[model samples]
Target: MNLLDIEHLRVDLRSRERRGAPRTVIHDVSLTIAPGEAVGVVGESGSGKSMTVKAVMRLLPRRATVGGTLEFRGTSIPAMPGRDLARFRSQLVSMIYQDPRAHINPLRTIGDFLIEGVVASGQMNRAEALEAACTLLRDVGVNDPQRRLSQYPHQLSGGLLQRMMIVMALLPSPELVLADEPTTALDVTVQSEVMAILTEQIRERSVGLLFITHDLDLAAAVTDSLAVMHAGTVVERGPSADIYAAPRHPYTAALLASRPSPTSVARPVSIPGRPVSAFEAGEGCAFASRCPYAIGQCRTERPEPRTAGTRTVACHRSDELEAVLAEGVRA
Candidate 1:
């Protein structure tokens, strides 16, 4: 069974300006991950990547209403009782936020922050939790685990704090990890190191990972599969190498072409038009306005996800435009 299974998942928030009318933020998003597999969710900002993770964690705002199937190991997450939900959050899955500073308490020591969750959840006593944390900290390449634990969040560098957060996430031996751009706050050098540590640890522990990031290159580098999201929906999804080499969806192609490549002398192609939120999208395809291959039909009909070669794509012209997208990338 898959470690995580999400199908046709929808999330809506009550809009105050609209007099409590619900605005959809996530629409028909489906993804799955297996043990020791890393699935990358890549998209532009406000594309519902973070919101999807929040839904899995059941950390959505009180006003948010979720729909569709959200299952972990064949069990319904939304239907889990209070005690089961608590255990689910503590033992089954853990999240590593992008910004560690904001998540960590300024007043708490590193040891206190790391040990509190495990102890509170009854996973381990305080002493055992602290020892496990110190060992994990050392394993992640942080020197002097004992001294680091004595310090506060402000005393550590961004990279160190992120590594410590990785330790916290793994301390419980969770079946899955939701990493929301965990390396976004560090420098390029630090980012690479932190990512390497994270992937290594997860792989060693045979834990599933759902990595959310906007950087396509970084996502492709570390993840086994790639899911390209736009307007709160997955536009394309497949193996990382196949999707990177030949994107089946126009949005995915445009995203790849827009990235800066060291080997390419040609200028990066800039995608036209601004991205729309799920609520702002019309009945037709959300990307129709900006898609160069869009036709009259694309403007009036929403395309459902269909298998195209090795990937699933939601595009009216995917069959005819596949070559065009690949050629455009080569140019």
Candidate 2:
């Protein structure tokens, strides 16, 4: 079953500059996550991947204007009442943010921070929740859980704090987990360990996960499926293995080619031209300026998403591009 559904979701934020028109940071993006499945949304910085998930959690700023059908377990999220929204936020859905330090309260003890949601939601008494928190901390590989709980956020390293955040997210047994670049700030070794723990726990519980990140290889390694985004739109989406083997969209191919490999000594292949902001994109293809295969039509008309084999791609030249990419892979 689908745990989360989004269709034609658009979000416009008030411009940072006074007197400027609202800028549409997210435009007509759609995605779905099935129970027990992990889907990664991969994109460059400022590509709206984070904003899209933020919209799913209803965590966008008040100045943001949002339009879309966001459903969780067949229930409309935007239309939920205050009590339902609170329950959803606290119990049904949990988020692992990018920075653990920013999310936790420095004044509160680690134990208090970990158990607050369970206590507030009335799911467990304070003592019971505290016990559960300790168990989770141990499960996430933290040594001396009891001692760690007594300390403050400032006392722990970045990796340990992130693991704590992961434990906290799973404490509620949430049906859906939205992880926004949960390992971006950690070292490579710690990043891998944290990701492994997260993937294992979420799979054990059969919970849905929406992982957002800019690293295509990392996304492919951790997720079952991927949605490649550019300028607030999903340019391509498919099974992780297939997309990594042969991407159908130019943007997806470019991202894959940009990854560094020890066997290659050549300079990394970079996608030409900077990505356009949503407001800066014109009527035509948003990636036309950077796509080496762009034709006149690409500069004049937007391409709607079309199914190609087992995947979907939003590019007018997808068929031709797929052949080229596949041939290159074989070579």
Candidate 3:
């Protein structure tokens, strides 16, 4: 079953002005996830990656005007009202947001955090909630669960705080977990552990995961599918290996090249030119200015996303570029 289906997911953060103008944030973006599937949304900061999910979760502030079909478990999420919204967020779908320190309350104990944070939202009682919280901590690989329960957020390390948030999200046993950079600010070792715990927990519980992050490498490590967002648009998406091995879009290719490689003797190649914002698009392709393969057609008319051979590309000259890359590799 399709757990979540988001199409033409446009989110404009600006309100209809008291005068007459309006601004925008995210443009048309689409994606789907099957039950228990883990899909990663990757992009630079302010790319509308977070905003898009925020729209779906209905977590965006009142000023935003959103237009799109967000279906969760065959039901339209955007159309949900009153209790349905609350019910869906708590019992069906959950979000683990970025920044654990800021998220956690210094005044609250871990048990209090779990209740006010996760357990209190649903049907679990205080005793059951406490047990559930302990189990969740253990499940997320935090040792000495009982002792940790008495500790505040300030007492925990960065990695432990992150693990706590993940546990709380999973305690609800939600069908879909939208984790917004769940492993951020942790060391590489702790990052790996968090990923392992999350993947395992999601799989074991048969929960679909929407893992959002700026780290393409970490996303590749944890997800089966990759969706690359640039300046509020998904410029490229494909199977993780396929996209990593051969990114069809210039933005995707540039992102891959920007990462350091052990085999490389020099610093990583940087992708020149900044990405276009939601309200700031030129006449042609969004990536044309930065695309090395762009031609005159690219500068005049925007290209819709299309499948070329094996991968999808939104460039006017993608076929030629693909051929050139293929031939160069062969040589």
**lDDT to native, each model:** 0.93, 0.89, 0.80
Worst 10 residues of 1 by lDDT: 13-22
Q: List the residue pairs that clash in candidate 1.
A: none
- What lDDT tens digits, residue by residue, belong to model 3 across residues 131-158? 9888888777789999999999899888
Off by over 4 Å in 1: 17-20
- The number of clashing residue pairs in each candidate reads 0, 0, 0
- What lDDT tens digits, residue by residue, belong to model 2 across residues 1-331? 5899888889999977889899899876888899888999999888999999889888999889889889999999989999999999999999999999898898988888889999999999999998999888878888999999899999998899998898889999999999999999888888998999999899889989999999998899989999999999888989999999998998898888777776878667888888777777888999999988899999999999887677989999998777897665434
lDDT of 1 by residue, 44-132 (tens): 99999999999999999988999999999999999999999999999999999999999999999999988888899999999899899
Better of 1 and 2 by lDDT: 1
The candidate 3 region of ten consecutive residues with least summed lDDT is 322-331
User: Which candidate should be chosen as best, given lDDT against the real structure?
Assistant: 1
> TM-score of the candidate numbered 2?
0.97
